[model samples]
Target chain A: MKKHRTSPTTDSRYKPARPFNADEFGRVRRILGGKVLFVQGDAAVAYGALLAGCRFFAGYPITPATETSEILSQLMPRVGGVCIQMEDEIASVGAIIGASRAGVKSMTATSGPGFSLMQENIGYAAMTETPCVIVDVQRSGPSTGQPTEGAQGDIMQAKWGSHGDYELIALSPSTVQECLDLTIEAFNLSETYGIPVILLTDGIIGHMREKVVLPEFEEIELTWRREPTKPKEEFQPFLVDSTKIPEMAIFGTGYHTYITGLTHSETGYPATDSQVDHHRLVQRLCDKIRDNRDRIVQVERDYSDGDKDTIGIVSYGVTSRSVNSAVKMLRQDGLKIDHLRLVTNWPFPEKEVAELSERANRIVVPELNLGQVYHGVREAVAGRSEVIPLWKTGGEMHVPHDIVELVKGGVK
Target chain B: MIVRFAGFGGQGIVVSSYIIGKSAVLDGKKAIQNQAYGSESRGGECRGDVVIANEEIYELEPTNYDVLVAMTQPAYEAFVPLLKPGGTLILDSDLVVTDKKLEPKKIKKHAIPATDIAFKKFGRKIVANMIILGYMNTLLSPVSESALEKAISESVPKGTEKMNLEAMREGIRLAREGKG
Candidate 1:
């Protein structure tokens, strides 16, 4: 478990995103000193990428998540980076992974349908251990159920979206501020672990606005993939060195690295031989994330005491925001309760959540999806506490008042 | 506070809500504005909602709206039930002629001659939305005049800022000033 740190550091709280200027480094370094700006959830997703130093974004237009792509389209280009609206979502993901291999921070965004289309590429990125970020602004539907709606249905898809056994990093933001911070974190984890990071958001949080104090564009730190200082011939793209990360170099950079969707060795050439390289490659792919859960996993608990006297609410994304408001309302009405709003959906903050669930009267999981996070909550607590699932489908976000009713033992 | 504004095509209803929305943003309040106008070049029925509060607002749609501003009869009739008890309902008296069924005491319906004032007084019917926004400011008083002026100045593209600001002021005067 690696140490986890999040942003919009206290200093950035009071700062607004300023235009580019001189003395920016010192000013921004000091400015991230105050309160964090509040913005809508999707804006936060877009901001997270911006803060993470993501310079390359290729995405196709899709609802809900389109705002994330649109904001990047405007901001990335102005910052001397490239933002391309590709022909479709698959091409968008393909471009992002390709750009990431080129040693630049890159990301692509989409909704549920587009997300489904990107799964094949997601598996390829996993097998190849390519580093990048994918933002899925979840909507309601198995297939275009609701365009102008919101849903947490993609929660399971994000984890299992790409077909594979490899663990992933999927952070769901309930507010715009988290979007900004988590986007940066997504990039960081992607680079750090050598895997594609998913920043999951529902339509409600993605499209809604909240007060966000964005540090000037240049003020935020961005991490690009580390390039090979070693000569091209000496580089092993999938080398099983101690660091578990290769000195990545892009194809056009004179690195001459072989690229493929097939299983390959450290040298980048496709090989069917499992004894020498294939086994090591797959293990490293999984180890990259499994080994760094702490640094990669991010979660937050508000009023989570885990007492039997209190019925706890577990939720993420927009549901978490509603739960926060509902908890406040319930408390005012004299109902004792606790709320755990998950910022990171995958990597399931097991230890902390398990500890909290042990003593709580009940753990009620509410989400825009049918019952994705509830599965993790149930497995984590191991039935120590009652695991109730409050699932919502389509795009309508589960309101806070509804959560209050559930907390009082109204419905699961 | 959740505020919903509805009107017909080219009624400046979206523009009116934007003026209020931008003013809130200028005042540094946590504000969010969402518009649902038709994709058609010519609008059939267009509507938008603005949510502003000291704390974070989760609901996107106006729930028990604090204020309702409408430009056409359909706009007023559609939004009447949504008004919270004791909420303020402002409309373009000249444009909205239909009698909508709404609780008179619970909801205060105040109609101002927005089109008449814009066309007859300013000789520019296009500024009717700004006029309605101006009148809205007088009744709601949620945002400061300086902030609204600043908001209008920046929000309305560079060339049209000055005229829109004046139209806003005139609209405010029309609604705020006492009966002659």
Candidate 2:
């Protein structure tokens, strides 16, 4: 059974024991500015859709993530947007893809089980090179273990969830504030790369409240799924230029285009020839993201001081915050601990990890899931430096002290 | 100045904490509010922590809590170690039966009949969270009495606002009068 954890916000029992300070609260609130809000990660996705020019949302109610669909149900109608709660994850994804094809920015959100269910469709999106956004507010998985708790368990799934050799772009946020910011980034990357970008969130980062300075509407750069400049008879959705980014045209927009799950050419028709347009189309999908990597990846480094000889901790999602906590405390104690917090989880951040691993003898990768991202880190750092994978599951975040102790123990 | 509150899920945890956070933000100080909850909705242990620092606060949880409000025995027992030695622990006398093993010379635990007072005087079980919040003013004079009162008045529902403010004022009165 795929048991899911539902976040309890509307419950009457929700209460806090202490008093609050709004003006003092406003200080940090002003940082992100107008977009600032104390919201869950699911709601953050809904807002990200609004920011990303996404006009449609299709999703089923999945635990630790149902609220994203619920918020969309309420907010979509007001924004001239459409939200459909389909029967299952597969259908949910199908609706979003169809909506995107018919010329609307679209998205869907789910957890591990739903993500697993959507794998075939993800392959379809990848092979077809369709531009869309899929958000997985990751939870404990394999067979629905713990739902409400947070986990970075889906790092591997985000990278290789679909059973094919396709390119994927995933973004992991460390806080609720980043949830909003990164979801927008996911939408941008999805549009820019013409692939389905995943806004990867764990239970903790999705729901935790941090002062988010919301950017005003004007500050956000919005991109539409590209439309063809040529006449309707001469349109090709899969055609690519020097940037390897293809111009996407809607179905009903006077451009008669046919899109399929099979490898297709620039003319929107399937092809089996490996030497011709088939290989070229596939390569474009990979290069549009893999080649223009720097513009697509965002990683935050703390206390690095540009030296890696000191213990370096690499983490993402909620565990990254614990790493930050551990790093901040270690720095306060006059310890040289450099931390790499990966906001962009996909494309694996191969270059930066290699750069950091060279100077530092000790490197720790602490995650909420069991060794998913650890493998990626190990592969990137290779055997030149020590890449330790510390993972915890079943509804608990890795403590900062444990991360610090792990780093210190690496020295011993 | 970070007022970090931790308690189990059903102990009016987020409500009382949000009231304080919302009030603090209105008072013009930079504030950050956060909560931690388990899977279960009602009885799961939870914590609502707020940071009211003068500047930006990168740290999320209040590891060093300034004012700790705990209603259940487990909640108090869990967070007492995180206090900065001299921090205050306010426990509801009704829900929490065991005596807090607090340091008399350093950490002082104030026992208030909060829920009982609400049930008897206010005739509402939910007001217990408010009664203690009202009494908190006595120990915490960092924010002004009027400011906290204004916070209470502005918060809560329209009809209940008056009664909630009264409960908060009574808390202030009790705190001012002391437990003699």
Query: How do the residues A1-412 of candidate 2 rate in per-residue lDDT, one tens digit apiece?
Result: 1112111111122121121234423342343234334455666666766655567999998778888898888777766689998999999888888887777778999988899899889888887767788988888877686776667778887878786577978988776767777777776666666788888887666665555556555455555555676787877776666767667777776776888877776777877666676677766667777877776667776645646477778888777766767877787777777677787888888887887788778788888776877787788888768888787888777767777777778431
Which ranges of candidate 2 are over 4 A from the true structure?
A: A1-36, A273-277, A303-308, A410-412, B1-11, B24-68, B72-86, B100-106, B141-159
RMSD of 2: 8.9
Task: Write down the worst ten-residue block by lDDT for model 2 chain A.
Answer: A1-10
The estimated TM-scores of all candidates read 0.89, 0.85
Q: Candidate 2, residues B70-113: lDDT per residue as tens digits? A: 78878877776677777787888776654445433377678888
Q: Considering every candidate listed, which one attains the maximal lDDT?
A: 1
lDDT of 1 by residue, A1-412 (tens): 1222232222121122222244533343243333444345666776656555567999989877777777777777655679999998889899988888776778888898999999989988877778889988888888988886888888788888776577778988766666776777687667666678888877776766555666554555444455666787777766655667665667687876776877787778888767656677777777766666666565665653334566778777777766767878887887657666677777787776786676676888887777778888888988788888887775566677777787787854
Global CA lDDT computed for model 1:
0.72
Candidate maximizing TM-score? 1
Q: Can you give the lDDT of residue B18 in candidate 1?
A: 63
- Write down the worst ten-residue block by lDDT for model 1 chain A: A10-19
